[model samples]
Target: MTFVVGPVSVRTPASSANLGPGFDALGLALSLHDDLTAEVLESKGDERLEITVTGEGAEDVPRSGDHLVVRAMNATFDLLGERPAGLRLTCVNAIPHGRGLGSSAAAIVGGIVLARALVDGGADRLDDRAAFQLAVDLEGHPDNVAAAMFGGLTIAWIDGAAAEMQRLETTVETTVFVPPEAVSTERARGLLPETVPHRDAALNAGRAALLIAALTVAPEHLISATEDRIHQSYRAGAMPESYKLLRQLRVEGIPTIISGAGPTVLSFARGIAERAPQGWAVHELAVDVEGALVR
Candidate 1:
């Protein structure tokens, strides 16, 4: 297959996974986005893989094939049985890296979608399902990728090693309190115990189920639905300030959750922007329904 003659761009929204009780299974796409643009270049050798970055993570992220976006694009092209001779990719990132905001997932989704859109008949060959599977494989989890790919709110799971997901529309309003310092998802996850009490598991399961309704038809149930008996409190020490803020907000009857892995707190209510802690940034955003789209 031939590459598209001109540059192709993709707009991929940021995702917040886990969404309280659903730990690694539920995700929501936020209005915040990252845009990636790429075009086939005619250069050779080192010049063949030029990349430019701006906005978040630009100064710290790798510029070579080690870059997550570049790797995802290469994987997509490999899956399509074709490879571009060269590439020039530009990333204008808006999502904060390592902030529990699914920045990595957005990069993965954007790269895959951008690559597919770059090849003629790529969409027909690598359909959404195939692209999604590739994305899940690359991300090592389906929750964030699923929401970033399908948009809205997604419940994702693995079946026989295959990624599966259900996307539902949600008009949930959210306000994210992002601390000045970021927390590593790996560090946060490492703090969790290998096992939990059966009663706690049961509570989480029930709340996860209720979360679906809370995000959709029953917004009032969000407070109860977003409660968790696992993960959050376990990893609280690593992000004490974040957890404290979560408790403060929840005590006030707001449905607040530690976005993704932690350090960024997401509340399912608006008009509370002034509640953010000192040195924290706040953004009010609605659910993004389009996922990743070519522009």
Candidate 2:
């Protein structure tokens, strides 16, 4: 019989995706993280799931199994080919959901990490690639998952039958402005048109390549690298202020880019004073190099 054991916890970083013209291809892991705890216990027929939330936007987050953490736990159980004896989950969310900060991906990744630790005894037996795939399945895209899993800046894509990943080093600073309100990811996705003009498609492809090149070959070119014609423009209706604010920052000598499918706007600047906009909570941050960890 499985007896009660100490809680297993996992922490995962928040991510910002799209990076202007890259759309679903480029993403970066931020220094912020979401922490999760799961306690395993002997069952007295208490098969139901329980969850508690605190920190950040916890007051508005759900405290039931229907939440993303619980859902990921269920997926883990299914993958393991065994039912969880019982799981009591607690999520301390530091990342705001739907703000293009990859809060959901964090929760999903956190759950998978905890579940693996509980079942496999440690990380040795778990397949890192499979774990990332599960997260991508949950995330509906690989951009955020790639960054959260690998840290720093990640570029991911499917290459026929296999997946490819490349991690790039970024020398520039990133400053993000998170609004008080939340924007639904589903709503942001729904706004995208099914097709784009050939010229627009070509434009985004060229800019995406240039952006990647700038991140490495010419860091100074990044001021012009953060250009887009596809997703960001179409998302303006959902976040007009972000668009206007981005343009305004550019004029102020700080180049701002839309973070993922954002309501969160990010700017690249050389220094703190140079980065701060007229009005916004500016967080000067570096990329998370260590990825996710738990002690």
The candidate that achieves the highest TM-score relative to the unseen native structure: 1
Model 1 alpha-carbon miss at residue 53, Å: 0.5
167 in model 1: Cα distance from truth in Å? 0.5
Report the C-alpha lDDT of model 2 over 1-295, residue by residue, as the tens digit: 1222788778889888988888889988888888888887656887756788898778776777778888887787678666566678888888877789888878887777777777754455457787777878777788888888778888988766455668888765788887666678888889999999999899889888988888767777776688788888888899888878877887776667888878888877645444434555556677887555664
Name the runs in model 1 displaced over 4 angstroms: 43-47
Q: Which candidate has the top score in lDDT?
A: 1
TM-score per candidate: 0.98, 0.90
Backbone N/Cα/C clashes per model: 0, 0
Q: What is the lDDT for 4 in model 2?
A: 29
Candidate 1 per-residue lDDT, tens place, 62-104, comes to 9999999999999999999888888999999999998999999
lDDT of 1: 0.94
